[model samples]
Target: MEYKWIDNFIDGLIDVYGTKDIYELYDSLEISIRKLPKCNILLQGNEAFYNRNFLNKEVVFIRDDLNMEYEKFILCHELGHAIIHTNIITSAFSRNLLNLNKLEKQANYFALKLMDLNMDEIAFEGFTIEQIANSFNLPVKCLKLLLDSKNQNI
Candidate 1:
């Protein structure tokens, strides 16, 4: 089946949710995922999850023991999968990118799009990838690739 593109998904969500800031979007997802439903179980695990038929749902697995940016990124990435790949109706990727090439790309693209970052600001603002990553408190490699892709697009 032909997949519905992620841009369309985000556009629709934006229309319903109004224009939310990038961090706010992340924060909202963070809030929603943290409060896992008991029986309805939109999220099934703290490590990760993907519902083939579910429109948009994911678990970030942010337990108290995991206190790190990488842990935070897990939530972001799971949200990315939900937002970008839900229509595919199945997933075959591991948490590590080495096993799942396509999900890795999709997740990164969704993350950057959700951040609402662009090349003009990133290139002209004199902020290095590290600076941007630091400001966002995200992993540097993630920011680096996102900025690089934006540069290539420009």
Candidate 2:
């Protein structure tokens, strides 16, 4: 599925929060990811963390117990929400009521871009899907999404 919103938001992010690097981009946007103890009550049993508008700013609360790989992915995903969904923060409607699948997929795309992930960095000729995912510290499912998006672009 094509999501025009992703392109528009990415353009806006590049224009508004452009920086010398990804770390600077995050800083320029004032996006922070804080690690907290794992608690099911916090985000209603979500796997990792959650983002919210706090004091007119965007904040991500990630589980401290998550492994480094999960940490990287979750941080990127929440950052995506902060950048791509900033405008909707003031809306009364719940994001869960929206096309959540599309939103999640868009966030995945946003994350990969922010990470500067290059498929060329990984060898695929003889590697299994699981091997590729493990080598790159990525979830296989998300890797598939990234590959699919890349294929579509090509």
Q: How do the residues 74-95 of candidate 2 rate in per-residue lDDT, one tens digit apiece?
A: 7777777776765554243775
Measured by lDDT, the strongest candidate is 2
Off by over 4 Å in 2: 3-22, 89-96
TM-score of each candidate? 0.54, 0.76
True-vs-predicted CA distance for residue 45, candidate 1, Å:
13
lDDT of 1 at 56: 58
Please report how far candidate 1 places residue 152 from its true position, in Å.
Answer: 2.2
* Residue range 1-154, candidate 1, lDDT tens digits: 1223765766776787675454466566543445333333434444444443333543343344443544455555666776666555443363433436667666766666655654457354877767777766676877876766655762
* Candidate 1 worst ten-residue window by lDDT: 35-44
- Candidate 1 has a TM-score of 0.54
Model number with the top TM-score: 2
